[model samples]
Target: MPLQDNLSGYNSGGSDPSLFFLSGIPGLEAMHLWISIPFCSVFAVALLGNCTILYVIKTEPSLHKPMYYFLAMLAVIDLVVSATTIPKSLSIFWLNSREINFTACLVQMFFIHTFLSMETAVLLAMAFDRYVAICNPLRYTTILTNSMIAKIGLVAFARSFLLVVPLPFLLRRMPFCQSHVISHCFCEHMAVVTLACADTRFNNIYGIFVTLFIVGLDLTFITVSYVKILRTVFSLASKEQQLKAFGTCISHLCAILIFYTPVVLFAIIYRFGHQVAPHIHILLANFYLLFPPMMNPIVYGVETKEIRYRVHLLFQGKSF
Candidate 1:
């Protein structure tokens, strides 16, 4: 059946939908103000932490290696993820302004998905960076040159943008005859599409395909890289050298865990946890988006000596 015909039965009224209402937290209206406080704090920390990482990376010449370069990219992705969701979420919580224009919602969804895909790609690239540094130390610099880094960055951005560009249009074509109320804090693609009156099989299928092909593939590569890294580390002659080599990966591994674990969990819950409480789904959705940006910088700052040193210098008012 044709999509428009399938949606023709839906009573969309005479006017096309122009705005969407975001349900911040169902049945917890009284606690929204209190809720916004911690959310605001987390958002602030994420912004400060990521911005600081970017500033330190930009100012410090010695931190211009492939690993740090990937870190910088990850910082940018974190910033994008935070920015796309937090401010509007704060507005929804504090000011009670929940109506988002159709165009703005589409824009937000595009960037969120784009940057998320880019983040996975960046993490994969970082894993590859670690693999080279640990397994092929002598050729690390030669392999991951400035040009190569730029190419990787370009490819990541392009892949994400191309893959997600169709999503907004797909949603736009659907007739949202059901309530225009998004049940989560931000403008998630699935949340928006679920309101459509027409068959959303294509959307669901495409979403899963993107998840499996783009994100799943990245996860597989990262796991393989780490497995290889572990093999190489175990074969080292000295325990000190083994520990030292593994130490460099601690931050990246922590980052991978923080970013991917919640994402997978949320996906599982969204797919199979239909009986779960609405608040559980809502909270998990928010956490999946918020926690990584807030925690990634802290993890990297504490685990990476170079970043820590540079951050310390900045706090001491010393030039990098």
Candidate 2:
């Protein structure tokens, strides 16, 4: 775990809970309201941007394609990601309401992890979409039809759901006797698990397995897709053609970095940086979740030609 627990070992078997108290950050409670201002601003932008993406993609028939369909799915996941944690976190920051029921905490934890895995899978699916479009241009439509897209979506959801639904149940059997105060604003899995009195190796090991299998494999496939994409792109005869081919992938590349960089950083910190302060971990954890939702639509809106045009017309009050 990235967070350091000063009182972890003593609480052996006494778990009593009407609630678990959440914190914005352990030591920076005094500045939570100030901290929330930017958080709230980001949330607002995410809400508006993703909603715009959904609306634009849905309203424009020209925008309907496998690529745009994946973008719409990404937008929806971003909305769910924001909707899951931000409101409760804001409540803790603004209203000084920190108590979350045990069951509610479990639910929050479940959504957080589940959606994170789903995002990885979605990104992987998008990578595959790009792969087929670039490598098999003539057959792209045949390869990624609506039925295939639906199946892909279902697989992503099932993979994430099966992997993450166990996390809350794993914690449910453990007794949280150490302290009711969760070290972060939401019920992060390790944060909640650390307060447990029972042996937690099973939960911890399962977490490691999930990370390795899902993120590791997803990133591996994404890398392979991009490599093949680059090969086909460079094989183009003209420099202009090459640039155009590569340009189409820029937005997705940005999204890949935005989503995976934090996961990589967190993995390093979790495994090797246990000496770091809880406040720092909390801040980074919150920022990790915030950046993607806030940035994804912005990235696509600017880098995607059709979306940019649609957004322009929308702002100018042009009819869809």
Candidate 3:
């Protein structure tokens, strides 16, 4: 009934599948110290940038509108996502502390997936905000009131929590007869699930279903919303007004691309790149997780006039 015996085969003996070993760029363990430096820099920037976004939005009364509210929600989600993965990954890379307790790993996975889902929900809400603003300008304020924003935020949180709560349990129930060494830097859902010695057909199918129903559906709605916004913009009589209207969405669009493109790439590689280099897969996975949090604030700070103005004033020691 010992763990060593259980590792040979599932259900043969009782194994404490309660600990896992994390790896940092397999076959390049010697370079883990060097890798930690860039990762640390990225983490610092992500935290600082998201904090700045939160501060600017909170301080600048003009940014208290629905769009900026959604932006602030996004910053919060980015912060959660970054915090869930970066610290443990850094420890593994820098200190060679690669062992993680099963419960702690599950907790990390829960927060990561929950925040990711919330992010998609927030983006969908933002797209709706833009749609209403452009298509029904007169009712924008009335429709997306403070109360409505609160309701939407609650729904996003609830949806993410309800859906992802099953994932950790699902993983926990699986028999891990194989090695506990995870090939990636973090405890991603698919990465952890793939380690189970039992057949993972159900887990794989469920993961794909969640992706299609939750993330894919949000993307579909966001795209349709943007198409409608574009039509509305083109219908404007004044060219300048049309340009101004379209410009407002550039930041959100860029943020969407930054977040989703890497994700889609990682998913594709996970499914079809069985023959690809292990390092390539590891690097892409880390990039997808870290890139958005680090770049989102930079995109918003530069693209949004109000945020840019507030940032400039903050740097100049001027009052808002």
Q: If scored against the real structure, what TM-score would every candidate get?
A: 0.94, 0.94, 0.93
TM-score, ranked from best to worst: 2, 1, 3
Better structure of 2 and 3 per TM-score: 2
Off by over 4 Å in 2: 1-16
Per-residue lDDT tens digits for candidate 2, residues 209-301, read: 998999889999999999999999989999999898888899999999999998788778877889988787888898889889999999999
lDDT of the structure predicted as candidate 3: 0.88
Local accuracy by lDDT, each model:
0.89, 0.87, 0.88
Order of candidate numbers by lDDT, starting with the best: 1, 3, 2
Where model 1 places Cα greater than 4 Å from the true spot, the runs are 1-16
TM-score of 1: 0.94
> What is candidate 3's lDDT per residue for 207-256, written digit by digit as tens?
78887788889999999999999999999999999999999899999988
lDDT of 1: 0.89
Task: Find the 10 residues in a row with the least total lDDT in model 2.
Answer: 2-11
The alpha-carbon lDDT assigned to residue 4 of candidate 2 equals 26
